[model samples]
Target chain A: MNTINQYYAGLDMGSVSIKAVIISNQKITGWALIPSGGNYKTAATTVMTQALAAAKIRREDLCGIGVTGLGAQSTPFDARPMSDISCQARGCHVFFPSARTLIDIGGQFTKTAKITDKGKIADFLMSEKCATGSGRFLQVISRILQVPIEEIGELSLTSQHPIKFSTNCAVFAESETISRIAEGAKPADILAGVHKAMASKVNMLLKRIKLAPDVVLTGGGGEDAGLAKAIGQIIGHPILVPPNPRLTAAFGAACLTMETTSG
Target chain B: MDTQSQVKTTAVKGTDTAREVRPMVKDIYKAAHEARENGKKVAYMMVASHYDEILRAMDIVPLPTENYAGLCAAKRDMDRFLLRAEADGYSQVLCSYARIGLGFDSLRKELGHIPEGSPDGGMPLPDMMIGSSAICDPRFKWYQATSRYLEAPTFSIDVVAPPPQADLNRVRDYYINYQKEQFQGLIEFCEKQTHTKMDKEKLWEAIRLGDKAWQLWYDIDRLRVAIPSPMPSQDHFSIMVAGHYYTGTQKAVDFYQKLYDEVKYKADNHIGVIKDEKYRILYGGGLPPWHTLWIFNYFESFGAVFAIENVYRGFDPVQVPSHVTDPVDFLAWRTWLRATAYHEKARQNSGNPTVEKLLGIIKDYAIDGVMFHACRSCRATTVGQTHIKTELGKYCDLPMMQLVSDMVDLRDYSEAQWKAQIGAFIDALEARTDQE
Candidate 1:
């Protein structure tokens, strides 16, 4: 067994953001999140530094590290590059041990993975060359609506009637959203429609993998209440979004480091 | 955080025989050019065209335009041709090989010569064209479209490969009769185009040599079932050029003979394609993406090797038995056999033939997972893969992944995206094995 005081770190260098988590004795001790900007190596270093400070530990105290997500391979860190899918599955299992399926809508890609009872990925489906089913879709809409991404979800919930989007393409939908605004449609309605549109694409991926429950949603998009609500409504099941939904992959990476060291 | 060493990259080593055979592909196009220069007739044909032997027998150079298109894409020189086709109102959704071939032909006609920077010195204009119904609907239409550009006449042959569960015993004779007529019609067409009568002795000799090459290829493929597979599909793709295009010639027979010897020696010594073979994958369907075949090596970095793939598998078991002395009769039997062998094998097992064959391959090859690369440009290979995936789940608990990209269109592929997916898939395979 690992000593309770021995610490480990997991970092998810995502396309849009970098998330870092520190763990000791199987519990998360500290975590940090920040925009990735253009330089992932710098973002990774900064986020890990912040996470270590939050944990009240120096870098020398860490026993192991696991890195995941898009920038994993390029990160200048002494870490084993882990699969984002496996990391996501492990992270979901930490909070919801019974999670059989995990849907992670990240900044640039969406993934649906079937999780084994032991929190390993059994199989998975991912969005290919498309932004319609990802948090990037939300980012695109946020820019067009002139609303901060954090506020799009709550504002969407306040809509009386959400507009129905005709196209699922992000570029085409951008022009469509502008047209709706010019036609006197409410911002909340357009935002709500975008959430529904994103949910539809997610639903298609879920169906292909033959979604099983209890389902868990994680990643940057899971932070959006509007999208979660839309997905739950469309899939006819409640979605369990863990605390700090964006940090699960990092948490999973941390858990993996502990397992590798102890085993 | 501390700095670590960069990711180590490993390149998949293709066999020396396969490597030697690859350069011969360029010579094929060159031979066509030389043949046309010397005033010998040439015929543009699809890969599935049933008349390569007839054309070779007639001394007409078989210019496999589809193979040339793939070569262009492999060389990363197909954009100009593809752009020309798109500008000429060809849909991007059509088979990219067709688009490249049509675009190349249109450009050549406009330039009154081969386009500058064309791969392999460019394919020569053909005196005639031959298409087949076996591959996909586009197979014939693609040739018919090119025929207009060359002012050449086109001939089409039909092949009816039925489902695995179909009653082959009852329909076999009728199918063979139809196929024999098709082969006869093709020979007559060649006779008229080349102004040469069909030589029975030459045709018979071609059939005998083709049968020998097919037998050798089948033997070579079976060698892959060895632990630490002696050959990877990358090598298989390269070496298949002979069996595919030059089946009737002694050159193809010689190539396969050398390949079989090399593979046998490696298999007997327990030599694998990679040093540490962890997971054996079954590339279930779809032609390989030409430009990024290095992705196979990408899988190798994870200690995973594609041990076998259904597509580009060895020619359907040789149907020409020793007693088969007639050339037309042999071709008819071989064509019919190629169309029905998988289905016939599946009928013996009582399940979906394609799925049953895949399951059989998993057991035979000791495959840990399956990958179906659903090429966007070719519907024939892409369609029915979803159904196969669903059915596969009913029998085995293996991990399966489907990747989407075009076989010839690099624009449809993203290296970053493929790496991420492949990384995740390898992790899943690891997890599955660890639990087992």
Candidate 2:
């Protein structure tokens, strides 16, 4: 059996960014997140190297590696590829043991996963055929509003009277948002409207699975206070947000590596 | 033609039923072509009605409309036909199989001949159409559309849903009698259309053969209860083609018997379709995305095998009794049974019938998980699927995933999304197994 000093790595090659996490003795030692920029392989390698350097661990010392997310299968790594659902469940369970549901809003997809008490996935629903309810929708809104994607979430929270967006489609919503801007709508209100549209889509997915508490939000959009507020408002309950939401799937992947290798 | 050479096998080897039945499907298509060239009367029918025997009894070549749609989808050539249908004012929201069928028929009618890219030179134009009101309303409407286009006579069997809190014993006689009348009407129509008399003895023999084949199929399904599941779910696609298209023939019995022997042999030898099978899944709800059956091969690569599909179990002996002595009564009873099986099973389980049926199969097959295909074009199958999934959670805590795709429309399918969802499901199942 491997000793406690043994290190493991997990890579999450998401549509928007690549994240890596290094763990030793079941604790996260280092983590890194970088823009995927349509080059997942390079981003994966760069993040892994940075994460390993942060953890002060040698590559050979790693016992196993786990990969998850969009580019997981194609990433240049000799690692076990796992589903983001399992990784997210495991990763969130480590921080929020009471979490029964995990909502992950990535750049190109949104997933609502029901987690068992043992941190395994019981069921999950992923966005289908379109990117309207995902982080990509927020990116489109940000590009139209000329606001930084990261800052839009905080700006949305300041909206007092958010205008309603008629369409849930990203392309149509973009045109609607522009029309709203031309009509002198506040940027915060437009961002808030986008959050509301995203929340409605997420709520529809969550209803399908019948959300169980405590609901924990993770992924790129999980860290957005505005989106979470919108979801919380719609669901009629506050949600738990883990620290470094983008790294949770990677962390879970690393933890899985240890469990699989040790067994 | 070398029949063996014509049968295409996947990289992931399928059960004997799949291997033999695939060749039979090719022959069926070839026979249909020959029948058309010889000016034999051909009848287009929906799969749910169990009218193949009736057609065969009248010496009419039976062409299953949905099966042909599946062929077009599998060949990845459904888009042109679908677009043609859409251009002709058929809603994209209509059942994809209907769209493909309607589109193919319309395109052929316009060209005044089978177009070059038509799948299997397109299905032979129908002299008549037999439709049922059982499974989907669209099926009967689709048949009606085709009948009008072909200027052919159409016979529809009215399969009424059982009343709420209905006892099958009390309602069985009423339905059987009504169905018997319908069967007589169909026979009369066929006799007049084909200029031939109804041969009762030939019909009885065909029904007997069909029952025997269904019995063998039931046995084949039972064999999947074995650990490692000797039968692969994808193989069912080919096997069921025979079931749907050739139910009342000696060929059906022969195909099932050979398939039964092969699956039984594998079970006895402890040989699984997938090596090191770790997870067994039951696929329920909606038709499989015919274009991407390789998804089964992908799952098998992860040591996951789909043990059963609900649609494959549609004609199981348990659902329809196999020991009937009267051919007319047998056909009537079979139709009534098939129509009510879903509702009755659901009533018994106190859940959605589709889900309840899936749960029963899961227990019988020792399935590790459940996957529901939420086909965009198949509202009848997909409606209340979420309710079924939730209710299933009450009976057992098995992990479940719903994949969204259309049965024939490849445009609605997102391969990346499917992979991610299914990959996660397999991972969860593996984790549960490890925990145990």
Candidate 3:
């Protein structure tokens, strides 16, 4: 537990993707995101190796490791399991020090947390056991619309009349999207509607907790410009999206290692 | 994946006295079964019906169905009944307690006896039923539905409290008078069903016993105001069985008296439910998830002890006076006062009654945060919890979170999700405390 130029690694073993980030001298040096698939331990190791390789550091060189997300418990890593809410708050705050509110849209769940000035979570609100407001819902729609996940944001932005989805349930929304397709609706319009539905769901969660200034969106869902735009429009405020938003929690996990090591 | 099978029951008792509750409840059911075998009349009653004393006066075995449902849920045996009720055309959205009761009755009729593995020897078929809609309409209606299956005469009483904004001085007499009339009707119904005259002396004795037990219970509950709470809310949920289900009986009185002494001794010694008490939480209103009572211990792992719960606040509102010699009048007055006590206190504070009461509890208990379990099946508990949480946020600087799940429905809950939320909440509470 050296407090010098010690390296720290954080792995976020999320439901949809395993994310890893390496930090040195209080800065993120390398990051990796890979599909979690079915084996969390393998995913954790693979992502960690890639992130370590990118950072040009050996595994033994790391001073500490922090793990987070749904699969953190089972991951084969000698790491401290931190709540994703805490990690997300710390990571978002490091990128934007003014950030007081953070909305992390992970694969399966969306969480909204209030951050203190010192990069600590003050409170958090999680989405119920539903996928309509999550990245999985977006992924489901991507497969149905035959659109690449990466292309969804740009494609959805071009739509003028978004198909109005009737339900906020992920399963029901899938059928609704199919019905819209059968009705000869454009894919971009349907994707836009999906964004609106997702944004509306996130807005409901945001409304439940106290909304503060400098709202930052992170996690896989943060990568979608269409969703960010829709959420921004709904909340009547622009949201900050840092570079590689999905790595924020992993980065925060890495940053927390600094504190753990220094202590 | 059957979430039902995934649920594991825990035996961690919050207090030694609380350990007596399940056995006491089981013995009540056993007594009811023996009562039926011995050709004695038994009455199915709701927990908050306020008529257990009358039934006790008449020597009618009072089987509290809601308490039984809670026990079933706690034992993780409720899904069989719940699923049966769902199969019998009852909506899953209906009150889970009702579903369990109706399902139990339906299954008993089908099998010619209690279901194979009913917890505490399943509730005996009642000869009579006394139902009240004081808390919610479904409570009485649940009994009425059960009557259709069991053929037991069901008497439903309406005991609506005046609105929180109502001027009690103007409405108190009317409500008490109405409630007294309802009790009279209930007594006549019971007397007719049992073929016995109303026993005035016995009723008085029952009332006196109930009052004594309640006072002792109140003293026991107030001991939680001590820092490093001697008893956690999980223990209260168990220990409340006597006051809730067996009130007016000597057993209930003796139980409370013993519990009061035990808790008082602990409070004096500054003994806590957990050794290192860090965060003191106010269980801000809702029926707890009975199946996952282990969640209480999980919170304990984070050095959090639920100091008090407002859900089953059994003490008589001291501010609301009751000075009636007549038993019926006293019950009516007590019922009305208990219902409006929070609102009456809130009017003086000029805020939402539940919110005001919670803020006071937070202060009195030195609470660090609040956890509101929003049970989906029970609207009476779940509806305004978020509003209270929001109001608490506006009024106090404390960490609060709403946990949404059903008290009895396994399908509506996820332990992983709940534990995650609890972890985050405790972390936030610690961080906030550290900063302060």
Clashing pairs in 2: none
Model 2 Cα lDDT, one tens digit per residue, B43-140: 88887576668788878988878888888777777887899989989898899989998888888888888767566667777788888776788877
- Weakest ten-residue segment in model 2 chain B by summed lDDT: B1-10
**Better by DockQ, candidate 3 or 1:** 3
User: What lDDT does candidate 2 reach at residue B140?
Assistant: 70
lDDT of each: 0.86, 0.83, 0.86
lDDT of 1 by residue, B236-272 (tens): 7788899888868999999999999999999999999
Give the top-scoring candidate (DockQ): 3
lDDT of 3 by residue, A197-261 (tens): 98998888888776788999999888899999999999988999998999998898889878877
Instruction: Report clash pairs, candidate 1.
Output: B164-B343
The C-alpha TM-scores of every prediction are 0.95, 0.92, 0.97
**Lowest-scoring 10 consecutive residues by lDDT in candidate 3 chain B?**
B314-323
User: Considering every candidate listed, which one attains the maximal TM-score?
Assistant: 3
lDDT of 1 at B136: 89
lDDT of 2 by residue, A1-263 (tens): 75488899999999888999999877989888888887778888898999999999878889989999989977898987888889999999999999999999988899998888889887788887686878988888899999998899899999999889888788898899889999999999998888988899999989988899999999989878999999999998798999989899999999888988888
Candidate 2 yields a Cα-based lDDT of: 0.83
RMSD to the hidden true structure, all candidates? 3.9, 3.5, 2.0
